[model samples]
Target: MMPQQDQPANPAPLGLMAFGMTTVLLSLINLNIVDATLEKSFVLTMALFFGGIVQLIAGGIAFKRGDTFAATAFSAYGSFWESLAFYWVLNSEPIGLAPAASARATASFMIMWGIFTFLMWILTFKHSWNLVWIFGTLWMTFFLLAAHALRGTEILLRAAGYFGLVCGILAIWASFCILFFEHTGVELPGASRPL
Candidate 1:
């Protein structure tokens, strides 16, 4: 008799997958904004640069492991601005221009991601509506707030800080869900440390 072959288990629900990917993507995105907005501080610069790279790498690894949704989410945002950062560094003459351009870019990126998240949430409804959807929608609001804050609006800045903190907390919670509930044999690429 032929030996039986083991099939890969079905992946997590779309909502859960989207939740994990979005959380990771948004966290890194927020850090990028903070890096551009904050004054010239070495510690912050090194932290953001290295941290963002780590997150991007993790996202790539996750994608390789079959988390296509998250992999794309993390890698797309990671590469998008990281490439921009490199360009900005290479063309260093326009000092003031870089920050402004970064802000605008971040804003545009956030808006697009927000829309993407919404669409993902809608698709997730086909699976089941749950806390994941509720929190996901609320979480996307932070992106809108961050986009406004990057535009130099004081109120939006405050809102962004508040919302960003909330998003971070929610992300940690989602990570725990993936860590505890999902039984994928492979370890999550970025679970070892903060990204």
Candidate 2:
């Protein structure tokens, strides 16, 4: 019989924290609680480094651990962040693409992501209430942003920002729970089981 390899450390917490922190920052700007002046580079920087690269690393770890869901979530979202950062750069200032994309085009991009998030949320039912909530709010945030993009509605943007903030907080809580469990060997109340 072949011997089993040692179990890898869980990377979910790291991935979640990356997602959470990035989401929170962007959401704050959307909510207008923070200056949008930093939106041009700072948020994109976080998206590329922490949300994109870090999550990709976590996804790789999850893949090594044979966690299909985590691998998919991390890798896909990581790519989303990287692509989004590039998109903003391409749409802005010096490098702005010729015949720039229409608002409908941007709305389409957000809608596609919303659909993806919705699919992921469906799978979260088999995971935990925490995941369900996180994915649920996330999909809503995407859709709201898409609506705002399409209609140029400030209210929709604010709503998206609020939902995104909730999603970020939930992700952070899940990360903390997992980290706490890893350290204490006691599962916390939030992400212990499927609900």
Local accuracy of candidate 2 as per-residue lDDT tens digits, 79-187: 9899888787887888888446688988899899999999999999999888999999999999999999889989999999999999999999999988887678777
Q: Looking at candidate 1, what is the lDDT of residue 18?
A: 36
* Regions of candidate 1 where Cα sits further than 4 Å from its true position: 1-39, 42-51, 80-99, 102-107, 123-143, 146-151, 180-195
How high is the lDDT of residue 156 in model 2?
Answer: 98
Candidate 1 per-residue lDDT, tens place, 14-113, comes to 3233333443444345446445343233323433353245457656665656766556655654554466456445445555444445676667766766
Task: Name the runs in model 2 displaced over 4 angstroms.
Answer: 1-5, 97-100
Q: Please report, in order, the local distance difference test score of every candidate based on alpha carbons.
A: 0.48, 0.91
Over all chains combined, what TM-score does candidate 2 have? 0.93
RMSD of 2: 3.0
**Candidate of highest TM-score:** 2
Local error of candidate 1 at 136, Å?
2.8
